[model samples]
Target: MKSNIKYKKTKLSTTTKIALYKTMLKPRLIEEKMLILLRQGKISKWFSGIGQEAISVGVTMAMQAEEYILPMHRNLGVFTTREIPLYRLFSQWQGKANGFTKGRDRSFHFGTQEFNIVGMISHLGPQFGVADGIALASKLKNKNQVTAVFTGEGGTSEGDIHEALNVASVWQLPVLFCIENNGYGLSTPTKEQYNCENLADRALGYGMESHIIDGNNILEVYTKISEITESIRKKPRPVLIEFKTFRMRGHEEASGTKYVPQDLMDQWAEKDPIENYRLHLLTEGVLTEKEDAIFKAEIKAEIDTHLDKTNAEEVIVSTESNELNDVYKDFEYQNIEESSNTNELRLIDAIHEGLKQSMEKHDDLVIMGQDIAEYGGVFKITDGFVEAFGKDRVRNTPICESAIIETAMGLSIAGIKSIVELQFSDFVTSGFNPVVNYLAKSHYRWNQNADVVLRMPCGAGVAAGPFHSQTNEAWFTKTPGLKVVYPAFPKDAKGLLATAINDPNPVLFFEHKALYRSIRQEVPTDYFTIPFGKAATLKQGTDITIIAYGQAVHWALNTLEKHKDISADVIDLRSLQPLDTETIYASTKKTGRVIILQEDSLFGGIASDISALIMENCFESLDAPVKRVASLETPIPFINHLEDQYLARDKFEDELLALLAY
Candidate 1:
């Protein structure tokens, strides 16, 4: 697991050596102070990087300040080396308002955009893909910026690591995959984590050069990372560098090192990075004992001063009204001028046109998905996108949903608008973590805009079977930070999609595959935007109210047209997350009878939420109980008859009649 190839000593100037030493020493002292605070019950938790400061300081010092770094929780030295204000970082630890995440998140689980550092989510692997996106943006902008992302050896086993490596290699992005092989991932040792002798050996599988460095040696780590980053900046390719090190502390303060053998711990103790580096500095006469003592005293004093200030600051206090603030950015509806010219387009074509128009308007816009470039996607929504926008803008990704979703999030972070088309909405589950955890929560957590649109081709009726057919809007609607748009008509699809793309928050734009070619309408040729949280009433009637979205909207309209006796208000809720409550309540109170329809299974769909809302707000105006007509509670069937029997359409008319008669 050790590198046999010796590295020639790279001479450092006296000032640079002192700076590096100070950077490494600052985190050690700060963490020591934090541990004291944690033990004193002042702070909630701490993940100590007690003996692993070399990797964080060395790699951060080697990379340019303009380059991005996605640091793990243990990379406290990265923040210190980047010169982020110690007071702010202390406030973050204490969950104060001035922290990077504004007390929305605690500890190092927050990112500071001004410092060009992205903090990792609880799930460790997604930051790799986000780093790739930052590198991709650098390449597109010709900035020659290299992105460095850190992880442990155990994180190498994540699918995201593999996907990001392959993607960076294929795209020839300038990235440094910094793996601090810190002996163990929590209690799991490297012997049980992987079969490979060294984590760097896996780099060959990714078609990228690899390096193994003595992480305990600060000089070697700095030299190796500097050389690797320089080479990558010039050649623009990802390289894996495994910094062989050990975690001297538990994974977190609560976790103890009961599983680690005493002999191994004792062996690593002698190779303590800071102690060994200090000895090296003294022996070389670069730092005297008096100077080292002065540095330590200065760092300790600075940390104590900032700790007092951070503790004195008011802790985050949340109220019901203010708690909901910034879950989504305030959106102002723009009235776009439309030309008289119109085209009769299918739902898919309208979406295509909307994307083309958006891409034409926004130079930073890029579309990414599997087979979306030349294959035009499974539903052909992005058919000619590659030809219209170039391969760079129209990207085809490997079958790595989580990576691509988080990659799009990265692109958004770097001021690029991205549209990720999930081949099928059902596949969103594969990318669910990033969509819900990272992208959806980015804005609310750190005030970072994830200007990405996920085009989900959803719904059943085409008999594509269980995997491809699903109406999973209910999955994301409950997630607060995302905007969900499911348009029922071509005009609505085009307009709503345009609006979603322009929105600052992450938006899930669901397109029903069954309605792709079936629905047609006179959509405007010119660009326009339909405001979110607004429902479109297809038909206005006084007897009963029918609320639906996607294909079910068409079913409601068709059933109303077929039965002339049925007088109903057909409400198409184009946007699900920002439910059109005003329109729904008005219709419900007008008719006093309501039926909510959904193509998803009946048990836990959006219909259930809408029914509950009606009861809670419009209870006094109700004539009868709200009816929820939805698909049968089972996976979508492939057979024609079974599929029809499972869909809500088969029972929609009967349900409508019952609600009307109520």
Candidate 2:
């Protein structure tokens, strides 16, 4: 239904109208050809944006070129509006060697920093969170830039969307949240999605300005967006603009229209943005019919030419040499190869030192977490950072875990290295999608290095219980393209964090909460880095090998001290991703016995992997079967007695003696 306000004539000049017509027509024709390609099996899939061209064109024209746009698969018009090279678009669709992702990704799952467009996956919610990061980065830099995020009405139901909106609102970031309410999300109609009569009204809850526009009306879309864009540039506040439009086609070329009514489709077709805008231009004397026809023909010819050229380009064949060519950036330790100074520091202070030192080294470093600013984190790991680095670098984010990690990913994409802190390690599950799907695979898929360090204060013994205490290193260790580092000592904590921040891949730095105050060491004043995949042999022995990490290392050390007669060599597997299996095997072969220890649950923990590695490599050298000691497979109890009983140190010691005797 049209708005009650009287329809006003567009004040756009003839040249502007002509330009809009040409811009809007480009994506419509491109998408039409894409569907044809899909039918011919030349392209794998087709997500048509047939009726949403005006929104894409209008928003693109309203925002500056430097402002980033995170477009979904259906927003093909965004690429066209941003003037991404026609051949590059066709090449990406054809999955050619010169594509944005070098043919590693097909469809709309690609982005380039050069064009300020973010790569989008099928999941729409997280992209908004990532876009919030881009906007936050721009605001922090004091740049008059804004980021535009495009999502469908159905995506607004996702928790990540709400989280992004809340974060954007609370921070007063400059973000344009453009929701294309295109009637249906895949197949579910708007009736099943939201209870609100107008989606824009939801913005009022966040205390942000809201507007609803007839997306098919190109002139109206352009004028409203231009006004909002100007206002956002000045105030840097998020604005939610729900463009009311409809999808005239099925969800994709493969999907049929059985879910949508023929009448509804017909109604939307009559309100086609391309055709309506062309008629408006004609009526406004922007172009003659002959001129309009020639312009469309020219666009069709251009698309066809690019399509043929992209089709002719060589397809990328996955080769042995290039298989892992760009999975990780090669980094070598340059300075401070060995420890030289003797300055005692608590684990917490060491961590703070590492962050301070890293920030001193890199100007683009940003630390974001809950209560990390003036409050200095729940554990005070980032205390005094806000004062030292300023609020712009040491940001206190809202308690949105998904947005936290996703924002770090976005900031990394925009060339800002980020250190994200999950107040407690247990909360990593809340942000699992971005960490596993986006952060972990970004380097492997697009050769983009997400330079993010996720500081997780993990482990038990402090009686913080299951909700607060968790050793989630195993989850990330199993995930490819992520570096998992768990340091057991203050020295290792400081060194590993410095190394993690420098590493090109995303690193999950697990800091034991119990060890924060319990462990004190004379850490090096000068910076030093311990290479990943290299295990440190803390003590030498001939009886057996005790391989452990995190708090388990301390437990094993105490076990050895209690039974001095049974000499044991302890190996610390600092980095879980590039595990030092060689060190583990050598120690196991020498001692002829292995005991793997971890603070995580026994069912599926890092200890299980360690035991498997010992058996696989040092099976013949073993004098007895490998023993594993881990927390019981149950949620940590809130009571200290139950938690202590769950982690029986005596039982672990008894198992160690049995292995030694065997």
Candidate 3:
């Protein structure tokens, strides 16, 4: 069924058509280059935009540079409108350093702030949230720059899409969400995806003004986008534009696509943008066949040169070294390497002090989440924060984690470094989709890291069983871009929290309620930040090494005292992502055995990661196979005896003994 997109034809001049088609040469050339690279065994697979170039050029030409754009994998064409050079783009596809994103991400995931392009991410529905955020930030900054997000029609059903639209509508952000209905999300057609008559009407549920347009026509796309963008600029409100286009090629050009009907393909192919636009331009006398041939030859020559340059460039090098350097341009960690002079403050006091110092030091900092304003938050982590920073800065949000994270992403894009409290780590799952798909992948995708800090309480000992007692680090341990820092001591807590707020990437600052007021280490007299991924050896020994993080660090500290004969080294793997294989190996080589400790389920925990790394790098140095100590597979029960029987210091000691005995 054809969409009632309210399309009107305009007689574009020959010069206008020629100029637009010439501008599209780069993306079309890129599509052709994908075929050359694929045959040479350079690129494994690709998604060609051979027939979909006009929609991107039209939308891009309609927007200003300062306006935010969240692109999909298929919108690599949109990226050319950004400043990503063709050689660098080919290098990315060939997996090289000079590539657009420094090779931290795949070909489809490169963008830069130089283009006002918020990164291109691949989490089916989460880009909508980021688009909403850019819009929110525009409103907050009082800037006229609207945010444009490009996605597929298949992404409409995901909860994140609705969450983002609803938030954007409620906040009335200046965002134009463009859904490119390319008919197939991999194999499934639009017919199989949703039951709605038109995707735009779905926006009405969120109170957003939505319209559909002929995506294949450059004039139609540009005209409607211009009108909607103007509306966003004039009134600064959210609008949705559903582009009714067709995917001429398969997703990634690898699978024997069992989806997308042959008849639909043939029909859409008949309306192919590249071919149709060529005919239209020829009919309007935009160019003679001679001129068209020359233009095509020029595009091919340019693409060939780019491919040659890419293969000569460095390929698949680690950007891990580049991680720390490019992330923070001006934000510096407050270095405090002095002796501890302050008394051990309670966990609550420590949290308050750390946050106060952070917000004071950085004016860009903002705090938001449920009950985090004048109410001082559920755990009172934000006590007296609003009085210090005002309600606008220290925000209290509705009981919605997804909305809170989406808003934080928006604020971060607008120059606010947000510290969002998740109330309890258990509730983080509500926002977990964005964390892994958006927050974690944003930097790798766009090359511009949108920095947001998350502070949440996590652990299993405070009787908040099942729902609240989960050790949530495992959820994001394997995620690429995010940094998870778990501080065990009062000293480490303040330092790590300060550092987390300062870092440019999303940092999960996990705090323990059990240690909030009970256990205390000598904290610093003043504010300071401990660098991320730096492991600290609590106690040194020769028989076995115990690797622990967060609350388990204290447990390991206690277990070491109980087993002096064992003489084990206690190493804290504080930062999770850049797992310190160096420290783990050094300790393992000396001790001859390794044991990873955690308060969560041992079946799938951080301990498994430690085991894998040691086996990969320091396998020959081991005296025995590395063992793991963690909670049982079942959820934390309300009964103290049942919980204690499964997880704690004794369980850790038993695991260590088992490894030693082995």
Candidate 4:
């Protein structure tokens, strides 16, 4: 490691120096106590930060109290330095109800907004983008707050880290990207991870300043970080700092360090952060042998007292308690009366109007996606949005799907409402982790509000091939804490989108590409919001029931119009997650037969779930088995003839006739 010790010129007060020493020593002592508990089989796992006290304590102490820090699994010093209660921290490890996550999550996989600490998920890279978002919120609100996000040498390889770095640099966000190069990512060493000599060197490619620090030297780590953060707060720009350190313990207690060479361990052992800092303080006359012994003893006693209190706390036992009730916040839809004045508009125009009105209503609302600023996006839905809302609100992003989605989560964390438009619905797969894992589970895990609207332009009939067109509502509907909205007509599109933007939970809003200009209706000119989980009965009948959403709703309506003789109930399900089962069951019982339609493939689609729901609830009322009319089980073909054959539209009439005859 390079010796970048530039701490000679920086003078620290005696009081500050002693405080730093005490803060750094606390987690190391806590780790030792936790190891004893692990051996006693009282705790399940532990990620020891035995050798990494300097980076966590130094960086966190350097940051302002109002600023946020996103810490990794091993940075227990961050929690301690931030003055988090020891009893609560121990309770989290013990899975007690008093923990940060209320025992919904384990270890440091939870965040406490009260302490301005955002904890990392198991997938470490997403937090970088989330940090950028929090910084973006600060920038927008004109606050001099810098967000510090940490990752390891192994985590730098993730695409999200690179994307977040580029975004921070491009947007001039105030973010401190800290990398702890601790030699190994699990069992893989730095040599096998990346060919770059130093992870800080990668910052040059992002046009950001980079620095290397001797992470074992507490004074050096503190001085450099304090200087860097002061510069960031003044000018509001991101900087990358690579802290060259070593993990003295196994990645976890269960994962032994047998793979690490013996000589390498001995070399790192000689430079233990806490031991070196204590000796340096003693040599500088800031600490004496008696004082050091007293401090160590006091810390051990504090840990024991907290551990005893934590042991007395009750462990979470009820699986069916408040855990189920906390998955999503109750969203009561406001009934905004529609105006008598109306305009004949296409589905796309209705969505645009709704978004424009929403921006007018909420000053903190921001919409981000690729080509959304100047180009108006691929479909021109946001053509005039940038000019109206300004660049800050109507932002354009790179082709980093994961980063943008995770960034939206950060914005929500900072009390800003956001909308993320995926250029195509098919690209959702690239950003699935933040959407499904982080965003969906955040509220249930820690009561974090994710007020984000993910607008996905989906469905086929435009022949854009498989990559550009898809009906993937079923993907998000299966994930709890997400609302799925797929409106069929112009009025429904406008109203449902308005509702989605105002919702407190994450919402997946699917706009059908084929219905953009094809479907037109006289929509209310005034702002209005349609309630979710309420199916609109377009046509009322008693003979049969046709349940559908998105483009399939149009297919059902067209089929019913063509066959006037067949009386059927055509239900347009505007929202899928909070499904209107009352309307569905009423129609199913009124008519003994049902046809569920969807543009997605037949196998494992939303149509299958609805079919099963009807069978289980209204089994005796069924004249024939609940029928599902879906696309063929294959990738949507590019050729017009093959595409037509792959769609469910062609088979709708035949399936309707067969079901009617039953």
Weakest 10 consecutive residues of candidate 2 by summed lDDT: 1-10
The deviation in Å at residue 267 for candidate 2 is: 1.7
Q: Write the per-residue lDDT of candidate 1 for residues 410-475, one digit (tens) a residue.
A: 888788989998999999999889999998888888888798999999988888899988899989
Candidate 3 has a TM-score of 0.81
Candidate 4 per-residue lDDT over residues 530-626, each given as its tens digit: 9899999999998999999989998888888889998889999888988999999999999999999999998889899999999999999998889
> How many residue pairs clash in each candidate at the backbone level?
0, 0, 2, 0
Query: Which segments of candidate 2 are over 4 A away from where they belong?
Result: 1-7, 337-339
- State every prediction's TM-score relative to the real structure: 0.98, 0.95, 0.81, 0.98
Candidate 1 runs further than 4 Å off: 1-8
What ranking emerges by TM-score with the best candidate at the front? 4, 1, 2, 3
Off by over 4 Å in 4: 1-9, 319-321
Clashing pairs in 3: 133-410, 347-516
Q: What lDDT score goes with residue 464 in model 2?
A: 79
Flag clash pairs in model 1. Answer: none
lDDT of 2 by residue, 222-295 (tens): 88898899989988999999999998778886787788988888877888877766665566566688997898
Q: Please list the C-alpha lDDT of all candidates, in the order they appear.
A: 0.89, 0.85, 0.77, 0.91
Which has the greatest TM-score? 4
- Model 3 ranges with Cα > 4 A deviation: 1-18, 24-26, 29-43, 101-105, 255-263, 274-301, 304-334, 337-344, 396-416, 433-447, 474-481, 520-525, 531-597, 603-629, 649-662
lDDT winner between candidates 2 and 4: 4
